[model samples]
Structures are given as structure tokens and as C-alpha cells.
Target: MEHFALAKEFPPASEADWRAIVDKALKGAPFRVLENQLYEGFATSPLYTGAATSPARHGQRGWLIVQPVAGASLADAERQLADDLANGATALSLDLNNGPAIRKAAELKAVAGAGVPVFLAPGSSPADAALLLAKADKTIVGTAGFDPLTVFAMSGEVPADRKAALADTVDAALAIRERFPLVTPFLASSRAWNGAGGSAVDELALTLAAAVAYWRALEAAGLSREDASRAIGFKLCASADLFLTIASFRAIRLLWARAHEAAGIASNEHILLYAKMPPRILSAYDPQVNMLRATASVFGAAIGGATAIEVYPFDEAATEPTPLSRRIARNTGLVLQSEAWLSAVADPAAGSAYVETLTEKLAASAWALFREVEAKGGLLKALESGFVAERLRQTAEKRERAIAHRKERITGVSVFPNLNEKIALEEPAAIIMEEAHPTVDFALPAPGAGERFAALISAAARGVPLAELHSASRIVCDIIAGGALDVARRDAEPFEVLRQRADFALASIGSRPPVFLALLGSPSDYRARSLWVQSFFAAGGIEAVLPEEGFTDVEKLAAAFKQSPAPIACLCSSNSAYGELKGAAAALKRAGASHVYLAGPASLLASLDPNDQTAVDRLIYEGCNALAVLEEAQRILRVEELAEAAGLEAEDENFGAFDEA
Candidate 1:
């Protein structure tokens, strides 16, 4: 009855008709060639259509804009928290480091008095939670029992008395349940796996498996399945891949609902999901681009039905965020909510056939992996057995390879880079310390441990030091005593290293690394590859100095080369023009060029005279390893190596030394 005009005007196109139209558009190319295979055995076709049955609908709306306060002192954190709350932030996340200035009970009171919900990092112990609880009775708190599994996975050192520590944390949660009804005692952080190079499916499967483990533990401690579910929350990472991030959150909700149903929990409560922007994808060189990345991530998280979202400051990778940077980050969400009207719609991607198809496929893949982990004795055992780590490593390696070869582009990193820009780096604030107090750990209390909770509350009331309150217990876990797990290296780190070498050269010798370009043929014939060579050099922080005119004479090219200050030279021209410059490489080397790179396909190397004194030292073309090429260029320019000239033998034979545009 409402606006049926469009549907009545045109008939829906069938799949076969759509395929036929696409085939015509593509000429004779195979349609299957467009299918993309993603990690964790997920593949997406070029097109998707609505199914015979509609997918589930997402009914939630609005997400909390969270600001993380990372300060050296309680005062610094409080100041930032107050400012954020005064602005547009709806929640505060406090990240306490291992400094000696442990937050006192009075300071904790002041923080909670701000009248906003608070989330403490796992670094805070149960004793810390107790102190805050004693001071504040109204505000909701999270991470009462920081999940020790995260610590075990990160540090590879099982905490002493792990079982007792976990029990005490749960008892504390149960003790304060009535006073703090919204407190979440346990956090299942999939962000850990995400930063460690795990794919989206890995993050989902690992988080679900970890949730089951925590639920079982809480149940053994006498908590009902519904209560346990209430006490737990999830933290996931948001990536720049917008649709994948949206689908991921939907998959998580569907999977959790199924799990809850299986557990016979009748409550139709929504799961608490906290999504944070990932720092692994951020770059320090062009941090401005990070703002764009964070914006996209926040959009995806909000559309994906995340309950709360945190956007990392653009300059987060360089230093502690300044006040201005924090404000910018906080306002990003404000603009989205108030101006963009993002919060007005719930599950914005729900009805889209593509998103629904993606969600269904991703959910199925994630559940399969989750079951496999359960069969392998749960998340802890899977991690300890190195099964989870191995899968993440393989995926990370493949991704890194793609990025290094320019198959995947990171703007301002392995692609179009601006070398002249420099940002002022700030020093992190100094940590302040006070006298320490010793902590004591006791045995695991029995199920429904009200007596232990009373004891803990009494101890906290007496001003007992947090360290003394949580002294080591007798329970120990040797299974997690191995070395820490490894994640993939950041994609921008290699290019940043090259930039560092160039910076050192600029500071020490007063000149950045320079590359001379020898152009041939008409401007229209060679302009594209010539600009390609410029961008390729810029990616490595190398300045590509071009000639005023195309040189057909080898002598004239050598003369121009002798006038240049750069030690390296590259040839840029059309395939036909390449035949005209047969002696150009030798002449340039004779003119004091340290190395000559030919900008073309690898097969062009065969066209050169093998016996010539100056055979092409390397080829610069598309899909080559940019990192390896930059390292070799640094060696040639004596930026990294002074004793040896860069050799051609180490370059990729089938490709080139550097990436092409």
C-alpha cells in the first residue's frame, strides 16, 4: 500500500538475465574469474541476489562513543575523562600501565564520581575493582575480573594461582551485582587475536570459544547460564574493510543468539559489543590518512550494531594523544551522530542482499572454526597447541606478501607517498610513583563464595593495599608457560624503516636519497611510466629527478647523468623506444651511475646485451617486492650499507626490485 510504484513499474531481473548482461559488458572474459577467495576459506562472487528466504533482521540502534584515557597519573586521566564527558563521549576506558603510582581509593572515588560508566583495563586487579566499588555505588563498571587468558596469550607466562585469581574476580562480581547491576565482570577480547594477524573468522571463532570457557568457569562457581552471560561482554576490532566489518558484527550476534538458545537461556537480552579501531593498520608517516581509516571503522561499527565504539587518534602510533588530537577523535563520533544521523537507523545494512549473503557465509565459516576449537579442547588448548597461532601466521604472511608486492595498496605507505612532510613527535608524559604495598593471594573459594566476598569488602574498607589483597594462591598452570605468541609485523614498518634511513641521510649528509630518471620517446608515449617511476621512488623516500626532455642520444643522456647528484638511475620509455637506448645503460654507468634500473617487464632483461659492461642492475615493474627494492636502493646509496655496493643477484628474477604504479 505504501509506495508500490517502483515495484509495479519494473519487473525484477532474474539471475540469468543479470549474468547475461554482465557477460555482454565483459565481452568474452569468464565470469568466474571475478570471484575473490578471502581468508578462512570464504569466497565472494562478483554479484549476489536476494535468497528465496529473507535473512534475520537486526533491531538494535545507537552506539556509545567511548574515549580511552591513557595517562601517567590519576590526575591526568581524570582531566581527560572530564573533558571527554563534557564533550560528546558517553563512556570512559581507563588503561592503567605497570607503573608504581597505583590508583588510591580516594582517587578512584573522584573518577567514578564523574557520573559516567567506566571500563578498566585487565591490568587492574580485583583489589582495584573493590576499591572503586567501595567509593562509588551508582556507576556501571566493567572488567571486574580481567580475563587471564589474554595475559597468558600475550605474555606466555601463566599467572601464579590463576584459578584462585579467577574465582576471586567472579566472587567480587557476584558480591557487587545488586549495587552495580550493569557491571560486566568478564571481557572476551577478540582484538588481541585481530592485532595478532588473525582473520575476521579467526577473531569470531576465538572469541566465541573463549566465551564458552568463561561461561563454564562461572557456572562451576555457581552462576546460572543467564547470569554468566550477563557478566560477560565482547571486545572486537574494526578494520578498514567496511562491509566485512559490518558482516562480522552481524555474524557475532547471530552466533551468540544460537549459543544462548542452546544453553536454554530464555532472556532475549542483547549482547554487549565493544569495537575499537585497530592500530596495526595505522601509519606514522602519513597519520592524516589514519583519520579516514578510523572514520570508516566507526561507520562500520555503528552500522554493525556495536554497543560501543572507540576511534584511535590519528597520531596514536607516534605519541600519546595531545588534547587537540583527543578532541578531534571525540568529535568524529559526535559529527557522525548529530550531523550524519547515523544513530537514527538500526542495522543499516540489514536488508541489503549482499550484506545478508556475506553475513550468512561468514557466520557459517566462523561457527565451523569454533566447533573445531571446541573439539581441540577449547580456545586455551588450541592456543597452547599452537593450532590457532599457526593459522594466524599463515594468513598474516600471505597478507604481508601481497602488501609488499603492491597487490594491496596502503595509501601514503606502499603507494602514493609524500616524502617532504614531517610531523612533530611529542614525548610521552613521565610516570609518577608512590610507595608500594604488598599483595596476598589466597585459595580458590568454594562455589557461591559470599563469605570470601565479604572478607574482600572488609579488607578494602580497611585501606588494605591492593597488592596485599591479591597475593598469589597455590593454583598454577604450566600449560601456558611457553613463549609468547607472535603476530604479523605491521605493513608500514618496512617502508618506515626505509624512510628512517633516508631521514638519517638527510640529517647527516644534507641530502635525501635521489634517483635520476632517463626518459626516452615522445611525452605521450612514456609519460605514464615516467610518472609511475616517480611514485615508486617516492614510496621509498627517494627523490626521482627527471630530465627536461627525452634523450634519443646515448652521449647526451650520459652527459645529463654526469650532471646529476644521484648515484642510481632508471630508464623509462615505451617498449619500441627501448630498442633505441641499447647503449644508454652502459653509458650512464660509465658516467658514474652506481646502478641502473630498467622500468619495464622482467622479460625486457633478455633484450639487453649480456656482455655489456653495464647490464641492467635491476628491473622496476608492477607487483615487485617494494621493501626488497628499497633495501637494495639504500645499500646502493650507502644509506644502510657503506662497505658494499648493492648487487643484482639478490633481486627477484621473475619480477623486479621495486613496485610499479
Candidate 2:
């Protein structure tokens, strides 16, 4: 069969024609209702036509499947690494913080053998990493010592001797570079910035600023511009939102080109872009759904042209990931690469009108913000001045507000929650929590500018500890904030708190918080609202007990309500049925319901008897505050007091902490 040029078979429709049809269908609703405003202060159109012009791909199409390896001991870690490597992982990223210490250089060697890239978290012993890679052949090691500024921003305390730490880090990088050409010992990670509630543009800006600051430091230490650029790498957080994640990755590349051009360096080499899933979006209550979240992140990163990607295990929020969870995460990447054929297309998002437009806007906004940070004396100075912290705090507050009001939905958490679902978590043998170091938030004055790269490298080569390379500071500026910046949080946090209360009720009292559904009229008339009411209650971990059958007789409905284990009842029905529900609502209140909620449009309840509070206490409908509604449900169910006590014990400080990749 020959191609018939099918598009020409129909006449093209104009924008005006489409608008007329939409407006007529909308029945007097405004056209602006279709516009979706993003947190970035921009609106996304509902439709697109021709493709927008996109930048050329400066990197490879394929991404490394960076898997996390952790265990109780070095031997355990080594075995875990071996299993992952043999299964399907292309690279390994270790979380040595919580696991047993890697006390010997041989341990690192045993975990990562040869021809694979290994990324270690910041504060990991660079000396050990250098020693291990010294004997390995073509193994790429990513060291985090070079990026102490991130640690400073996160912990709100600078190192005792800032200049010495900087010099030591540069020296470690120089030593590693000399011994193992594949090792990139310097990193500018945006993990802390993004995880601390910064937007995509803010994260990109801060990352670029940090990269620029490091480049200058490296150059001052005697490395050539090309070498300095090559020695530094980036780690950014990937979100579940598809277009934002894709545009964010692309924006960073464009920003990188501009950084090199501004520095008068003409290099065409692609910089390392490691994409890690943002822990802010993961939920502990519905860990299985986290798999879908991770998949979305990986898909976005792969399409956005990441050099490497790491997908956190779904059970990371609850406990150590079981072997099954680990394999699921690793194979998620494999299936995307081989079966989905993602690697075959370079810049998969390129030329997409929506993506290209978003990328250009993101780059422009990020560049402007980066310039602002630079103007505030670069990333370090801005952080010290509390500018960075203030901006992030404001954004976090706004996001939390949106979540509380139900403007932003977290599925299986804030919406359609399964209160009866059993959570599966592999209990760790021991959870080693890191103790906070006692320190003041004072900045030290530089005693000396710092040693040159050669001297530092020579010192490192002689087995000098990186921390002992410099002199103590003479100047102390007490500019540090009182506590660490708040961790990136999810919209489901408030609702999850409710679930905790329900769990407490079940464990302590042998029952879940219960809410009775007083569904009225025929199945077809009230079934949808009945299910809606059920889901709404479930979000608060409250068991919504519905009648076995819809009732026409008000006495039967009242009788069923009297038998319910809950003191709270919600009436679910159509507008016509609700108009006749005043008597039924009064009967439920008489049946011992402490509170009666009508689940429908608020307009339906506005005409009901205002004098009779017993008939209806409030309205439960879309756009109402979910947190408030759930709290009320808890109060009526008598679980509020129990929940309050349980919340304190259930707090997981590791909420948004991600496994280093």
C-alpha cells in the first residue's frame, strides 16, 4: 500500500475554529480554565503544533545504570556489588555512610573491580578511594571531597580550616588524576540544593555557580582550564514531572556551554551529568507505588540525555531494600534501555515543541538566577549570607500549603489511599544513625591563600590525611543558620501523619479509625459519590464502612448507621437525592453520629437547614482542605489524641535523604 498523505485528506482547522468549539462545549466556562500554571511561575498550554528548534546533542545517547550497593559489612557490600554487577548494572554507587565503614583500601577494590564507574558520597575518605583506584585498571572513581561547599550548605557549618580543606581536596584530585586517568575526583552536586526545596531553575543556577567557583579554584591551583573543566562533574536530582525533568537536564547542558564560553575556554567535550531520583517524591506508606515514581524519573532522565542514572529502591523510605526490590530497580533501567530502546535515540526530547520551549525558558531563568548568586559573591558567600536558605524556605512553604489545600495531589497518599494495604519492609538488622557533629556556625578567616596543586598532591602522596593539610582560620564570622536547611518534603506528609494515627489506633485499640458511609438512593445515583467518600476517608487511614446495599428507606439507613463502629458518618448521593437527605442526615445524627458530612458540591448543602447542626456538620467536596477534613475525621473517630502521640515516635528523619549516586 502506498502512502496517501492522510493529513491532506481533511481541511486544516484554525485556532479560532478550535476555540469556538471549546468555548461552546465549556458551557460559559472561561478558556483560561484549561491553562495550568506551574510552580516556576509559567503556564503550560494544552496543545502544541510544529516542533520547536532544539540545541544539538553534546553527549552520548546511552546512560549508565548506576545501582546502589550497601551492606552490614565490607564483605557484605562486596558480595552485594558482585551480585548487582553480574545481574545487569553498568556501574555502582555506594552508600558507605550508614553501612559499616570501609576500613581498608582493599575493601573498595573488592567492591568495584575494573572497567566500571564507582561514585562515592561526599565525606567519604578520598585517601582510601585514591589508594584503591591506584592499582585498578580503567576504573572510573567519582570522589566528593572537592565539593565541601555542598556539605556546608546542608549542615550549616563550614569546615574548621576552610582553605586547608580546599587545598587538600584539590591535592586529592590531582593525585587521583595522575594515578588513574579515569578518576574524576571533583564534583559539584546539586543534590542538597534541590533536596532543600529549590526549584529546577534554582537548583540549576546554584549548581552552575558552584561549578564556576570550583573551576576558578582549580585554575588558581595551576590546572589548565580544559583540565579543570574535565576534572569537575555534576550530580543533579531528577523529578517525576516529565517535562520539567527533561528540560532541567537540557538546561544544564546549555548552561555548561555558556560557562565555558564565558571563561574563554573552547572545549567541545561533554561534561558528566549524573541524574539521581529526588527523594522528596517518595512515600513510605505506599512503597510499591514508589516503583512507578522511580520509573518515571529514569524515563525522564534517559530522554533528557543523562550520562548516568540512579533509581532509588521503592522501600528506601521504610527500611533497607530487599534483594527483590534492588533487582526491580536495576532491571527497570535495563528494560528501558534494551526493550524500550531509549539509547537508540539521541536527544529524544529534541525538537519537541513543548520540550524545546520549556528548555529555553529554563535555561534563561537559571542563567539569570546563577548571575544573581554570582553577584552575591558566588555560591559560598550567598549561602553564608542566608540568601540561598531564605529562597528555599519560601518555596518549601508554598509547596506545603498547596499540598495541604489539595491543590497538589499525591496518589495513594493524599488521594485514593488504601488503608487496608499491608506495608512490606525488610527490617534492617541495625540502623546506624549518624550523630551530628557539635560545631558553631562561624566562618573562619583565611590564614593563608592555600598551597599549590603540586604541593598538595605531593603531601597526599605521602599519606597525609586530607583534613590535616592546612592551618586553622584567624577570622570567625558567625553567619551560620541555627540548624540544617529543611529537607525536601512530599505533599503527602500531612496525610501520612493521619495514617500513622490510624496505625496507632489499630495497634493499641485493636481497631482502625472508622467512618460510616450513609449512601442514599439507587446504586447508579450514589455509587460514584459513595466510592469518592470511601477514598476520601481512606486517605486519613480511616476505614470507611459503607452499607451493604444502597437504601431507599430512611429508617434502614439510620439503623445501619447506628450499627457502624464509627461515630462519624458521610452522606453520599446525587444532587436530587441530597435535596431529600435532610431527614436522613438528622436520623444519622440521632443514631449517635457525632459529626455528619455531606459529600457533594457545597452548593447542594447551602440550601439545607442552617439551624440544625445535627443534620450536617460540614461539607466534604473537591477543593476543600483535605488535611482539615481528615483531621476532623480523626477527631470524630477519636483517633486524634492517639495519633498525636504516635506521630512523635514515627518520625523518620531519613525522609528525603537519598542514596548517593
Candidate 3:
């Protein structure tokens, strides 16, 4: 299991206390006494002192929260934009969906408000670009235009006059730059790398290299290095890995600062960092799980230092997210800001050893990769030569292998206890293409590498190995190709179902403590008793996953054993009953679980027998020895790292700002 430490300085004596804090804090309650809002205050202390800075403070204005529109109706998009603007969204991502939508949104002058920037995502049409500019300021626009090689790959019948099709993207970009001085519209879109399964580091390195192409292309067109540097921005992925996300963004800006110096560009101004939600973590089943994913992504984005974050709606795992999902998507940023209080500070990761070490490692790795891309004649050439794509293909394959082996656990879809709840998606789906008017003048041909990708992989069609057959005309790197069938070979053996254990173990040790405490009481008493049990668990670890109905009966006991400690146990029950079930508890004691509590009258402790074990250890009373209990749980976790954690203390702060460390 990946190990984690709860920032040794923030450490409580036991896992229960640590977890209790997490639960209390995450409940959106006030825990500002210990950590700063958005994790900022305690950053300077020794334990958290070395933590790296969070993205929240990277820019004085804070990261922009954006949402994109693809193939959605202009009216719908305009409405969405209006809603986002009203709901605290930092920016707009217009589709041009087409010319009419562009025209329609541009005409809604009051909606955009003065100076609220709009960024056109990659692959945007010039006409749509013109429309966004007309409506509001769009100085730093983003694009997914095919890089020269991609253009080359897609270049089937372009006339020699339009050979400029490749060169003209820059020429057009320059013209727009002169007209819109603040605007930096070029290649920072995910149309290539992400659509093709690239790694986070690869994404950063390749995107930087591609930007180098625009610089070289513009330099050839008589634009100086300064202007070229001004034209490119970066859009990257923010998945569930918090440090990885932060490192990727840090690497980009750090590289950009260096590359600008190499290219003779003045000022470290204008390297836009655009981060987007990753589709890889999304699951089609019980789509609501996506909300959790997007939340983590946004949190990662905030920590990673994204200048702007585009939250993919929860339903984006398969279909276009509807209005409701989109609203949730936009509101996620708000929730993080208002409810979660994420935007109140900057560089929230600062002073953590793990985040700091990881940042340096990632930056170093990405830097080396960037140099390699440059060695291969820059990103465009790297793409054309299949080097970048092939390298990323390997990383993606490795990740796929890990998932198959069960090294990576995807909740709900993978390892866990079973559930039989029927999930019928009652929500409506959004239109695929309402305003997808990409405005490139000359028509481009097929994928320079002619292969198609799928929208989603169904359940039954998983586990089949990929077919490697390819035609000469295809961009056929077998390593980079998808499996022939939908079924994916698992990283581990398929899970087998079994009946749950009979005896339940009640363990509680962290905020209240994390012992898989069993509340073997009637439904009425379940809630009341479980409260103390949960408090006992939280005083020890992460938040508890309470049973839905919160009851522990015969069926419940069996179900609990699948996850909880084993052997049947009870809380607040009589000694006679406790002694009657000692055999079951004894058997459970032999297996794994071995505790039962009375929570009954104090007189019972004195009356219990030797086998009934009137021993002080057996009939311990609550509120009597809180300190000893706390000490014991700490010893337990000190040896175990809570199963899955970053395992380092305060790794984020070591950067020393501008590489002082």
C-alpha cells in the first residue's frame, strides 16, 4: 500500500485523532485553528515548512475556473456562459459551436461584463475567434490547431499555395496578435496528446515542444522570439494525484521561464497555464462518482498551480454533461472557493517534504524530456517522427497494466464489497455538437495517422488484448494503439464473491479512532451508539464510511465482516449476553476481530467472571482512560502508515522559491 503521513507537525497522537480532524475539517466546519484556510496558515512551521507552494498563490489573481462548450447549441452555450458568469466562474470557453452561436453570444453584450476574459480552446475557427474578440477581451486565447506534423499527417490534398496551411497558423496568429495586443492565441489544446492517451509529464513536455514549433514558425515568418514566446500557452491535465498535478504545472512554468531566456524573450510574463479535468479517472457507472473525481481534480488543480481550470462535468465520463451537471461543474470551483475556501490563499502545498521532493523530481523529469524533444528538432518534429507519441504510449500502457493488475484501485468499479442497487440514469443527455464551429480556412484531411478512437468502452467488451494490425496509411504505432476488443485484460484476477463473516469486530483507536467498530443494536439505538463508535474511530484515521442504514444485525454483521474486523461483537449489551457470545467472539478473536464493549452499568465490570474475563483489559469503561487509548492507537499507526498515503511529511515547501534549495 502507498504509505502516508499526516504532516508530522499536524499529527495527533493516534490515527483516530488525525482522522477525526480530517472528518471535522472536511465537514466544511471550521478547523482554521490548526491549518490555514485552504491549507495556508501553518505552512511556515518546520514539519510543513518545506512544502511546495500551491497553485492558488501562483498568480495574484488566482486560478481561473473555466468550462468548455463543444457541439452544443449557441443559445444553450450562451445560457451556460451566463450561468457560469453569475455563479463565480472566472472565464468562458466558447465553441463558436459555429458562426451563428458566436454571433449570438457576441451580441449578448451585457452577459460578458467588462474585462471578463474569454479563452477560445484549441482547434477554434478564426471566424469564431473574431466573434469572441468582438464580444469581450480575448487576448490570451487557447487553441488545439493541428501542430505542423499533425497538419502534415492530416494534409491529404492541400494545394501547394496552402502549404501555408502549416505555416499560416502562425501567420494568422501574428495578425491577430497585432490587432489584439493582449491576445495570445495558439496551440495549447488537448486534441492530440490527451485524445491519444499521453502521460501527465509527457503532456507538459510535448506541449512545451509544440509551443517551440510556433516560435520557430513565427521566427521564420519574421516574428521575433519575443513575439513567438508571447503566442504560446499550455493546457495540461489535473487528475486525482495532487502532487503530480502540482508538479506538472510547476514544470511548465519553470521550463517556460528557462526556454524564454534561451529564446531571448524578455520578461516572465504571459505564459498561460490552462489545466483541464482528465477523462481517465471518470467512470460511466453510478456517474455521480464523477463529482468526487472532479472535486479531487479541482483540488489537485488548485494545488498544482493552474492559472485556469476547466472542470469537466461529472457526467462527462460518457455523454455531454447536462445543465445540472455543468452547473455542478462550475459550482465545484465555487464550492472549493466559497464552501471549501480554496481561493483565499496561494501555494497551499508549500512546506510539505513529499510535495517538494516530487515537484523537483517531476520538473527534472519533464525538463529532461523537454530537452529530448528539442534534441529531436522540437515538439512538431517529435510528433511527426512518432517519438513523443510512442513514449507516451508506453506510459499509458504501463498505467493500463497497473489498472489491470489491481495495483490501482478504482472504487465502485474494482475491489470492494458488492452492492446491488439499481442505477438507472434518469437525467437527460446534452447535445454533442451545438456550436462546434472550428474556423480554419483551408480544409484539413484525415488524421495524418489515420485511425479512429472510441467514445467509451462498455463492460462486457473488456479484457480482450489489442489487435496490432495496421495499414501503411495509418499512424500505426502498435504500442500506442487500443486493444482490438472492448474487454480489457485486468491488472489482477477478477474478484470473486463470498458470504460475509458472522462475528463482528469493533475496533476504534484515531479522531474518535478507526477500529471497525460494530454497532450491534436495534435500529433506534444504532444512530445514537454509532456516534460514539465513529468518534472513537475518527480519533484514530481518515473519515469513516458508515453503513447506509447504520444497523448491525445478523445480515449486517456478515456484511460488515467483508470490510470490518471479524468475530461477532456488541456495544452497550449485558455481560451475560456478552459472555454467551464469548465463543463467537472467541472464534473471531482467533481470526482477527476480538473486542466487545459493555457501555452498560459500571456494576457489571465488577461482577464479570475470569473467563467472562473481569480483567481490566476486557471490561474497560469509556471516558476513563482517554490518554492510554490515544497512546495505543498512535503506536498502531506509527507502524502502519494508514494503508495508503504520500508517506512523507511536509514535502511541498522545499523549493525555496526560484530554486534556492
lDDT of each: 0.74, 0.72, 0.49
TM-score of each: 0.89, 0.87, 0.55
Error of 1 at 312 (Å): 0.8
Q: Model 2 off-target regions past 4 Å?
A: 1-6, 51-55, 122-145, 160-165, 424-479, 488-491, 551-556, 612-615, 640-661
Backbone clashes for every candidate come to 8, 1, 109
lDDT of 1 by residue, 353-462 (tens): 88898888888888999999999987777777888778777878878788778887889978888888785545566665333434354443552555555565566666
In angstroms, how far off is 641's CA in candidate 3? 46
* Candidate 2 structure quality by residue, lDDT tens digits, 116-143: 7777764444444543453355545554
Q: How does model 1 score by TM-score?
A: 0.89
| CA-RMSD of model 1 | 5.5
Model 2, TM vs. native: 0.87
> What is the Å distance of residue 630 in model 3 from its true position?
43
**Top candidate by lDDT:** 1
